[model samples]
Target: MRTLDSLILDQISGGADAGSLTTADTILVCDDPTGDLTAAACGSGRRVVVLDSDYSRCQRAISLGAQIAGDRRLDEFLAGSNGSAVAVGEMPKSLSRLDYLARSIAGAGFDTVTCVFGANNKHLARSMNETLATSFEEVSASRGRGKFRCLVATGPRNVTYEPAAGDGLVAVGGVFSGARADHGGELLRSALPAQLGRFLDLGCGNGSVSRGLDGDITATDSDADAVLSARAIGLSTTWDDAGSRFPAGTFDTIALNPPFHAGTTVDATLVSSLLDASARLLAPGGCLYLVHNSHLRYRPEVERRLGSVEQVARNQRYTVLRATAR
Candidate 1:
């Protein structure tokens, strides 16, 4: 178990009140990719319902005997749990995501629900306590253990659910770049060819790249929240892993602003997998427009996988590359 997970489990299980894990009949887990929390919750002989926005994490939780909140918004799933449940998980890195979770849990109309979320001390913020206080009547923090700390919130206050508002996009918390397009995404969007035949926005967070594009445009993201955000803006999107659900030679033009972070850790494999997928999905003579931090230098990989590559645009922070399939 991660240090944060262990701390959270100890804090909730050690308590003897109604908020104790032993007293609660239902436990809702959020974003537990390792399944450690889900397994521990299930082992306590309570009904475990997991709400993970990431598709891969949802599958992992299901394999651990935790029920998944399929096609249900956070508030909807929490509402079905009858309000007398304990919610636990790792604290999200984004303050907006934390606020969303706190609000959703508070608005679930639970007669009594206590939320226990832990994270590395480095990731914890004073704003998180303030965010939770907006929804719960009482909020407290546990002592640091192995550089991890748990925040406990109880007494849900009645609040209405509201979708997260973005600059021009309707986004859920934790989606990449939130409601606004990042510099890399904007660079790639501007570098796109004038006449894109069939466009595939790979790893399309909030459909920023495909926004306002005409003719056979589709978006796909691994995060369910991202897919929801894209769909809300009238973009056709699929909740998929690197466009794996589509067949080879499916698109004539592909736009990518790949994610480099998996939670707090930088994982280069994410970008590599998308590169391979884009190469496979593009038709003969198809074009790919990708933007990334200049330090990543994806030129060699793009050349190896997708044939010819050229730097189409670059600024201080980002570089846009265009590659053509052989």
Candidate 2:
């Protein structure tokens, strides 16, 4: 088992008491993108309600035999809920978003919140623990094991958030690059065809590319927060992981900067999924424009999914590819 998984199993197996989940407990699991923990905890006793701003993660949680509470809405689920909140995966890198998550968990009336995070994200751990400490009456932590940690906080909930404007989107976090455009996004934008017709921004983060262009464009991302941010910037956005809402052959071009990590772990499946989705969405002779780290070998995947691939641009760190649909 993975180190984090083993540690979590140990915690859960030890018992569901002393700030841990107990029989028939209503528990909120946060940031569980993979739904592994939700599935494990769904066996008995606890009623697992998973919350994630990422729409795909929410769907995955539901597929694991856990019912969708609040229609898989993270913000709505966090408000005035009656469950003990627990986070068993990575934390957002954005401090403001982390603060919002912690404050929300505290305010949800959870008497016990247990979080297990990779020790590598010390800043995230420190911030969350501090937030819990300030919001609750008691907080304690386990010694870091193989760069993993479990923190248990219990007591009366005393959390409050000053309602902010714009939902303080950037402040609310979970979007890629945390409110700013990423370098790959900028490179992909610079390489866009001068004139465009129907196109897509697959895996769009804040819809940066589509927001800058004027044309028949659709932006799709798995993250609801990203879709919200994209719409706020006047870009047409859809919250879907695989662009399922759009019919096939619906676009002339697709631009992407697919994320390749699950937390700190580098996983290339996300890149492959984006390439396949772009291939399925493009009309014959349509083009796919994408950017990725120079080290990742996506050329083979592009050739397999789309058609002949051409290097459009390359920097010291990023390589942009143009693949035409056969």
Candidate 3:
């Protein structure tokens, strides 16, 4: 049998390394297990914690003929053995693997945790490292397999993540200290109306939006993993395909940081659909707040659907739009 390093490196073009493998390490891996790197990492004998946002992937890992471990079953399996674990498919789709991994450790009561993502999840890696650096003793980054790697070490000492000045959205309460909205919790705190009664937080990553709200707020996401994350954070959430069945006129407020891509491809259909959904879901006089990268062409859709849209705030890279339901 081939060593894990050789196998991973060969497939990822020397991007994989065994040197980072440390002893007794509880590493969180949020990657496609079908991918070679995960297999290599698993073979290396590290205490692998598998986390995939996809329910299918989670189910596959738990079945009899599985190759990867489950996320939810990790604590049970890791009770005595030094072998790897799969966290099952309980992670949220809105959260990148890193966020899912962080929330997993926070909930699982692990002293320290590290995360590794494939090239496809680089954006997630960056956000994770930047936001959750202090929670883990060490927050490190590496490049491999056309992806980025994030390693975080956690312990009793509380670490915090802060988005830099001018980043627009700020980190809010209960985010860094193992709260439901640690990563983008502030997005919820900011976008949510103070007197929110029935609302919807679209693309609620890690359930921050729902957690920030006082009463019932419907959380929705196309990513099953994200929906799971919202639920994990105790948010009443719904998962949909973005093609059918969104709660219509069932909310007073709607919010989103719409996704920019679909599996690394520039797919705007999700965002466009969100705009339409927001308009349809909001009661008359209801409001929709959206934060997005400045360059994305969302204004047209928002205007077409809502009759009018206004910019609430603007920065170099991001814009916050608040549109009213006519």
Candidate 4:
């Protein structure tokens, strides 16, 4: 178990000992990437349900002896729990995601519910408590242990989800750029050719890069939240990792704004793997438009994987490169 997971379990056990959490209540483990909490909760002879957006994580939870709610949406799961569910998980890094989670839990028609979310101290913020307070009547922080602490929220208040309006981009929380155009995505979009055939928006976050584009466009992302956001805006989307599900030479044009971070850790290999995937997926003589931070220096990698590379656009923060498959 991760250190943060241990801390969260300690907090949950403390709550149960204090009579706030009962075994009769179903424990909803939300987005537990490690599956430790889900397994532990099930082992304690408690009714446990897992609420995770990622299909892979849900499978892990199931293997750990936890039941999954249909569709994996928090609201639907809590509604069936009959007001006797307590949620536990690691707090999301995105404040918008945290707020969305708190609201969904609070609005499940439950008169009362408790949520325990833990994370490293560096990841936790005062705004998290404020965000939870918007949905729950009470929000408090636990004492720090091993550089980790859990946020506790109780007394669910009546709240409803209000989708953000304007900008035509409909993104759920945790999706990159969140209902707005990311600067890197905008750069790649502008660099795209006016005419495209069999276009693929690789790593499409919220489908922003494919918006307003002509021809047969398909968007794909590894993150379930991102796929949901992209589909919300009427784009054809697939939840895939690095275009791995598609056959080679499937796309004539590919647009990529690959993610550089995997949960607070900057991993340059993610970009490299995406570059390789894009190269393999592009048809011979097809073009790829990729945007990244100016400092990543990906031109050589693109040239080695694809063919000749050209700088299409560049600003202080980002560089857009175009490479045609050989």
Top model number, lDDT = 1
**Decoy 2 TM-score against native:** 0.79
RMSD of each: 2.3, 4.0, 9.2, 2.9
- On TM-score, the leading prediction is 1
- In Å, residue 230's CA in model 4 sits off its true spot by 1.7
**What digit string (tens of lDDT, one per residue) describes model 1 on residues 194-282?**
89999999999988889989899999998877887898889999886789899999999999999888777777677998999999999
Write down the worst ten-residue block by lDDT for model 2: 163-172
lDDT of 2 at 99: 55
lDDT of 3 by residue, 245-310 (tens): 565678887777666766547787768766777877888988888877778778878888887688
> Residue pairs in steric clash, candidate 4?
none
Q: lDDT (CA) for every model shown?
A: 0.84, 0.69, 0.51, 0.81
Q: Which lDDT tens digits does candidate 4 get at residues 122-235?
A: 888899999999999999999888788999999888887654434989867677788999888888888899888999999888888898777898988877678777888889
A best-first ranking of the candidates according to their TM-score comes to 1, 4, 2, 3
lDDT of 1: 0.84
Estimate, for each residue in 16-131, the C-alpha lDDT of model 2 and write its tens digit: 55644443256556555456666676754577776566666777777776765422334546676664555554455555555555666667765566554433435445667776
Clashes of each: 1, 0, 23, 0
Error of 4 at 295 (Å): 0.7
